[model samples]
Target: MTRLILPLLAAAMLALPASAQQAPTTPALNLQQNMLLRCSAAFALGQRLQQAGAPEAAGWPPLAAGGREFFVRSSAQLMDEAQLSREQIVTLLTRASQDLAREGQLARVMPVCLQVAGIR
Candidate 1:
């Protein structure tokens, strides 16, 4: 997933495959779908953390409430770009986040979550 997303999201370094014919802002359905899927997963984690009342870490930069909103709004764009319904988007996000949580992968992915949430 990072292989695909890093290319697309890494500060204008977009070198999309033929399938990703659309512009970076709007990837085609097959345009490295995992990029948005994984990002949405990270965003889902952010929402969960917010709902759980997790405080800002003492050392890390403070996480603003708007970060979650950014992810939520971005999810809509993801769905629209891929022509997916809300339920489909929700399912993808839920499954990815759940799998990561079940496998105790949060520690590995929190940095990614923070990045996707635009924390830095």
Candidate 2:
């Protein structure tokens, strides 16, 4: 079951629009949004794993903590690169979480996150 999920997740990510894969750059901000975006997805996946009583729930805290740290540490760089405020990034994270939940993609979360973290 797990073996099949990674490819599907990769395909799903690939299917997203190029704009969705990259953040809009403004005069003040010019960083690629991939890191933040992947972290956001991982964070959301962690939340879903926890809610679904999945065994992977045990990994959520570490994932969430790592994501938070990455976001905080890179916020200045990301903000400067994309002209996005901290609040805006938070909003993006929330929206990402909500979207994942709404899409019923819980089964895909764990494997995607593991891939995001380079664990699998």
Candidate 3:
């Protein structure tokens, strides 16, 4: 998965559209959404670290536990604040992640990714 992340990042960067750097079409995420996004990235990056057998990841069992908590709260927020069913939320997340991955394909995002994960 760690190996895949590098190639995925490269391919995603190359596939970015010229307009991806423009402002978003939708409203900003609410507070819950903000937490969800951070936790989601942390969880994903943490998992990638673990999969690569990083020694520090052993300290992150609590991270997985925290992910479950976030998932629960985020799940509830999906229905209440977002008025989205779980399946719809899943679709939206998949699409949004894909979009982010694509925007990440843009050169503008590479330096940030490299700084964060040495993936460039």
TM for candidate 2 is 0.48
* Model 1 agreement with the true structure over 1-120: per-residue lDDT tens digits: 222322234222233353332322333456446655765565555455544566622333434454446556667777777877554554455556667666447556667656756676
Deviation (Å) of 119 in candidate 2: 5.2
lDDT of 3 by residue, 59-103 (tens): 445334444355456647655776665444444444444544443
Q: Which ten residues in a row have the lowest lDDT in candidate 3?
A: 104-113
Each model's TM-score? 0.54, 0.48, 0.43
lDDT of 2 by residue, 14-90 (tens): 66567655763334222346445545555546644655677856654544455444545555656676777554454
Whose TM-score is greatest here?
1
The alpha-carbon deviation from the true structure for residue 7 of candidate 2, after best TM-score superposition, in angstroms, is 32
Candidate 2, superposed: residue stretches over 4 Å from native: 1-35, 44-61, 74-76
lDDT of each: 0.52, 0.51, 0.46
